[model samples]
Target: DHTHLKKALVFTNSRTDAEETILEMRRMAAKRGERDVFHVHHGSISAMLREETEAALRQGPGPAVAAATLTLELGIDLGELERVLQLGAPYSCASFVQRLGRSGRRGDAASEMIFVTPEEEDEEAQLPARMPWTLLRAIAVIELYVREKWVEPLNVRQLPVGLLYHQTMSILKSMGEAEPEDLKEAVLSLPSFRGIDPADYDAFMEYMIGMGHIETMEEGTVLIGLAGEKIVNNFRFYAVFKDDEEHVVYNGTEEIGSITTVPPPGYCFTLAGKLWKIEEVDTRHKAVYVKSSRGKVDTLWLGAGGDVHTRIMAKIREVLGSTALYPYLAPSAAARLERARRLAKESGLLTSEVLPAGGDSMFILPWAGSRQFRTLERLLKNNLKGRLGLRSIVPMEPYYMVVAGRTDAETLQEEIIA
Candidate 1:
């Protein structure tokens, strides 16, 4: 490789992966007689080291590759990079495109990215491969950019009831006391909390006071009561999400890392790319301390999961319907799309206006993504469920719906259409 093609970035999702990628790259460089060419950057690394690496990359010319996590995804201007490598599939389309945007600066012909998929032979490994065509997604993203020259607007409307819960306690802890009106305004002013109704805000305060989460003093200030102090003093309370449990890491005598939750005993986990054994737990501290181990384990979290926009699903259906093929699609992505199309055609889903899944239930595949599905789901739940005798509703991807009870497909269709 030319010395001028020196500076590169290898991005990974996890901190451990970032460090391991850096070590492996350095080892490879040594074999090629370029041992000093790459560096590692991640949150766990010292700030001084991160600064030094940034300074060196800014100087440029001598070959250097920084194995990084999301830390390098945003700011920290390092000029233009010559090449970028993604170690695995980014969790979202938005994330994948953002990392791709980082390279090919300084008038290089076009940015280059090598998405390396790690070898895994398990059911979990099949999830990404089975997911809707990603290469087609990449193509769609690029084509959308070329056709409309627009990026998806950010969603800033969700009421941050969770964040409000955290901030109220934080304000009370930090400032000792705050006037109820002032407190309400402070939270309402945050950009993330926009569109929150004033009545709901008042209700939240009432709930807090009734529940004894906070106290109202005669001086018109909201103070942290016993319950509030107990919550805010705990370290796990720092984050907005309510933590279920805590895990601590102990390197013999030293505490290295802490996790909010821990796996059951004898289970293996990959953090930072190496396997670890959870030898002990300190629940009081919400920590699970572990030691090095061999094997792989999947991380599971509980939640309803991410939303898929109705428009994106509609586009996926369009891709299926059109005879046109995306030349840039990788073989795997192409095969997945073909299979999805075949399934749609076989089920008569492509042309059907209304799909009846089974007796007493109907599904209408609108080819909409998650957000529209959710919005539609809510609308149906409110207006149609009781009247139509709809017992349950579930939406599966690629625009398939599950409707239970006595649901008149034609009526639902008319409702949706009208």
Candidate 2:
């Protein structure tokens, strides 16, 4: 209730959730007879509205609460925000830090973050109900950051065919014409393309020529071909990553928003606050014509998925296996942990490292993380299918696997170990 004076920046995974959060906050404020003051800022919002929200956030000590997606996680400054709250599971360790750093920018006051974890269900699903994966994941991220200060290394570029294709076109467009060897040296020498070999470059250029993205002149120099010229001349060619040409979405004369792709007729989508159905699409102009229609539609949200580190998954296993209680957990979180532990013990999970389900089914606990577990799964499914007289071998990630066959859990464990 006292959050009015907090001057907070709240973050969620998707734009729809951000907008919905602000909407809910507005409703709460209205009930209390306070001004409905929460605002939303994301990529698709109107430029004017985004600018106004940013200006208000940067102005000063007044109540400026903005709920946003990762649009605010970058270098953009938004004055001295009092609180930074994370509403859902953060996608990565790097993102977690970026959102956390937004607060505590004001002098020695020390910035603050509040994570609101939802309550877990009691049903005996695949994963234990008590060990909330969301909360444990949050803890695991914090642990990784503190212990190793580790972030995922950039993906290796063994064959950057996409970038190579893009850059070759760019170099030709910029220099207009160059020798094949000279072009290879020029394009492949760049840091991003340095991994590419000259032979690969030659092959790529030859393919491009064959495909009409490049043309071989009589002088042995290469120039952009007719097809390549069409691409380079278009504004979309300069982009590193591929996307649809900017399609402006309009409801009648007024622009609701714009997206990379235009929906076909009768396809409904959510934009701003309400749903709209596509009326017409102009491919030549790259415009999506729409008209208002409101029932329910799937929210449009673009998010970057993260790969869980082996170390964090190991930490999650430790949390479940150990009796140590994390101090950061609230009472509810503590109870959740306790129930999970109890379930594990009652099922003979921690003691025998295996438990029974019903019929011929058994759960085998393997503390190894995803990479190892995946390898184990492949090993069982491929190698041990006939050797151990095994009927089935299943590998569940982050915890245990369900293995059922004629063999008992103990005998199977011995056989697998042997």
Candidate 1 lDDT by residue in tens digits, 1-418? 3222467788877765675665555556657775566666765444556777687677857567787877888778877677777765454456656787787677755866766554332434222223354443444545554455645667764776778888777866777788888888887887766788879989999999888889999987888887777878889889666555535556566544444446666666644433567776666766666787754554332234334454455555676677677655567656656765666566666676566666787766666666676777787789878987889987664346677877677877887777
Kindly list the per-residue Cα lDDT of model 2 for residues 1-418, writing each as its tens digit.
4357668888887887776677667667768898655777778876766777788788866687888888899778788887788877675678888888888887887756777767656676653434577776777776667567976566586887888888888987888889888888888888888777788778888899999989999999999999988988988777676664467778777765677655678888766545678889998887888888755565555543344556666676666677886776778877877877777666665566566667687777665655577777777788776776668766546556787777677776776677
Best by lDDT: 2
Which 10-residue window in model 2 sums to the lowest lDDT?
298-307
TM-score between model 2 and native = 0.70
Q: Compute the lDDT of residue 329 as modeled in candidate 1.
A: 53
User: lDDT of each structure?
Assistant: 0.65, 0.74
Q: What is the TM-score of each candidate against the true structure?
A: 0.63, 0.70
Go through the candidates in order and give the C-alpha RMSD of each one to the true structure. Answer: 6.6, 6.0
* Candidate 1 deviation (Cα RMSD): 6.6
TM-score of 1: 0.63
